[model samples]
Target: MNLQRFEQLIAAYGSQAHHWPVAERQAALSWLQQQPDNALYCQAQQLDMLLNQSVAPLPAPQLYANILAKICPTPFRDGYFYLCHWLWGESQWQHCWRPALLLGLPLLLGLFASGLSTPSVEDLLWLDLEQSWVLMMAGHEMDL
Candidate 1:
């Protein structure tokens, strides 16, 4: 690799050769060997040593409680939230059919009930014939 690229690798992955990506590790090593007195490499090594010695700060004692409070506000509402979470967290194909079945079952039942309640074409034709027979008898009685 070129000097500029070697400097970039050192900046991104730290001064340690092991930290560098496997593909570019050999190229960076060869470049470093050619320039044994690289100022950037020395500076990066110093920075890495300082960072390695530093300790991370601990979180607050109430952090877990605060996160839980934000995620689930009320104990009673937690059940509904959990149920929805479980339903949606499944695989995409499985989750898609659940809501469809829930809504479609009620819609199908309503359609079936309506079909049962409505009169058929044969029933309407028979009712019309009975009405006509009654009207014809009434006309004959009026003539008499």
Candidate 2:
């Protein structure tokens, strides 16, 4: 590989030859051997050494509790469960409405928004065609 590509590979995968893509590994090794005093390669090796020495900090117990609470919240704290209980009073058949409303509301809103948008599909197609025609004319003018 060229010097620039070899430098990019070193930067991306560190100076370790084994970490590089299998296809490019031999080429990279050859390039590195040819230019043994590459500054980028040395810098990458130093950076990798520093990164390997670093340890990740442990997360707090409270963070786990907060994430779990959000994922599987109590009926009293969860808006969907609370709303279902308030309106339908824990009937098994009525609980079906919960999933329907959850999925339908956003879909209905999207349909309403699309209906209210100014540009129709036909209008957008015509606009695209017009832009293409203008570009073609500009290219023709440039040729002259």
Provide the overall lDDT of each model, using Cα atoms, as 2-decimal numbers: 0.88, 0.88
Please give the RMSD to the true structure for each candidate, in Å: 16.6, 25.4
* Root-mean-square deviation of candidate 2: 25.4
The residue-by-residue lDDT of candidate 1 on 32-111, one tens digit each, is: 88897898899899999988899989999799888988886787677878877766658898688877776689999999
Candidate 1: residue 89 Cα off by (Å):
35
Error of 2 at 56 (Å): 1.3
Model 1, CA-based lDDT: 0.88
Q: Candidate 1: worst 10 consecutive residues by lDDT?
A: 80-89
Alpha carbon deviation, residue 94, candidate 1 (Å): 44
